[model samples]
Target: MSQKAIIEALKNPDAYDEKVFYVKVLQTHISYIFLTGRYAYKVKKPVNFGFLDFTTLEKRRFYCEEELRLNRRLCGDMYIDVLPITLSDGSVKINGSGKIVEYAVKMKELPQEALMSELLKKGRVDMNVMDEIARILSDFHKKAETNGKIESYGSIDTVRFNWDENFDQTREFIGRTIEHQDYSFIHRAVQEFLKNRKDLFRLRLRKGRIKECHGDLHSGNIFIADRIYIYDAIEFNERFRCCDVASDIAFLLMDLEFLNKSDLSNRFLIKYLEYSGEEEDFLEVLPFYKCYRAYVRGKVTSFKLNDPNITEEEKERSKEIARKYFQMSRQYAEEIF
Candidate 1:
């Protein structure tokens, strides 16, 4: 079946195992999420960007399973299972006996109002919530699996490679979403840090700060509910998922700051340090990662301006957000002292 046909088929409440009164579908560039009354099913697009490939049925199935496995680290019960959409007799039924056509990662749906991003927008997030977020993040980092290979990602060379890639990827958006001067400054600042902070990067590696972490650690990926749920981890690439824990921390911190909650970010960082028992030196390397995180956010948001599916208003918003992120990246670069 075609991807569009399968998507249309899945929109029926009858397509699910449990009773669902209605079905709503959300589409991202790489995946489609069908939200039911109690569960959400995510299906990968048969698209291959160089960094991620879900072009083949087998690759989609593999990533569906990988998403379930990796996200189970934080949301074991929420990431329910990986199910196949099968085709038989002109019928497309999920997990039915037929030719496997597509795969989906099924998850228990949580309250949308409880999402960290929503809470921030509603002004419902408090210091207590930030406190819990910090404690949970510290514990997760402590338990995350790490080895020699993971630690190598914290090396200066790898760090340089990532920054260089970010710059190259976003070069086209310089005048559209980011100012040329801001881009040049961020690039130069990152390069200077990589050249002069070899000792600091080596210390992070030696102290074992690298781990298999949640690559997308932002407000949108978190929920403040009965139990905190941090979901939607990066599963397509280990290079993105396995990194210096500081990078993971920086992503969330950059997100809070992006949401105009710099106080929360500052408080979260202090509490995270206290909970993790890391030295004050952790601050020394944080700005570098924060700058990297903000620049990457700018790059990705700017790309939405070119997405044919996104509305023109969304593209305008993306351009505005991307500019803010680049400016924040510049500020962080300036603070790299």
Candidate 2:
């Protein structure tokens, strides 16, 4: 079945074994997620944009499995397993006895109100919450896998490769969501940092600070329930996942700053450094990583304009958001470089 057909078929309650009253659907750039009452199933779309590729069924299955495995590192209880959506006698059913038409990452559904973002908006996230999140991440990073190959991703060349790819990808959206001046400045700042700080990158690599990490560590990916359940890691590309631990932690800190909660961001970073026993000079390289994270966020939001399904109002809103992220990137760059 095609993606459209699968989406349409999954809307009915019969598609799932659970007794669902109504099935809700949500989509991101790469996957369509169907939310049953008791569970959620995510199906990757057949799209490849160089950095991320889910163009084939086998590749999708592989990524689905990868998602399950990598996310289990922290939020083990939330991720159930990857299951095949089989087509049988002209009917599409999840995990049915027939030829497999698609793969989905099935997960135990948690309440929306439990998300850290929602809690943040409600003024429920305080310094204590930040400290707990810091401790969780610090512990995870300490135990995270790292080898010579993983440490190499922390090299200056790899850092340049990731930044260059972002610039190349976002060039088309210069006038739409990002200003030409902002793009040029960010490019120059990144290149200058790369050229001048080769030793800093090597210092990070030599510290054995590189490890497989949760690339997407924003508030949305976190659930402040009985425990801190961080989900939806960057599973498609090892380039994003395997990097300096500082780079991984910079994402959430940057996100807090985006929410105008720099106090919490500062507290979180301090707690993380304390818990992890990271070197004091770790602060020296953080602004660069924060700038990288923010600019990539802007580029990602700008890509939403390409989705035909998005309403005009949402596109306009995304444009505003993209601009803000780019501005944040510029601020981070100007602060040091």
Q: Compose the digit string of candidate 2's lDDT tens values, residues 249-288.
A: 8889899999988899999998998999998557889999
Worst 10 residues of 2 by lDDT: 15-24
Model 1 misplaced regions, further than 4 Å = none
The Cα local distance difference test for each model comes to: 0.88, 0.89
RMSD of each predicted structure: 1.4, 1.0
Best of the candidates, TM-score: 2
Each prediction's TM-score against the native?
0.96, 0.98
lDDT of 1 by residue, 154-223 (tens): 7788888888888888988989988999888888888888888899888888888999999989999998
- The TM-score between candidate 2 and the true structure equals 0.98
Q: Report lDDT (Cα) of residue 278, candidate 2.
A: 90
- Give candidate 2 misplaced runs (Cα > 4 Å): none
Q: Relative to the unseen true structure, what is the C-alpha lDDT of residue 227 in candidate 2, on a scale of 0 to 100? A: 78
Q: How close is candidate 1 to the true structure, as a TM-score?
A: 0.96
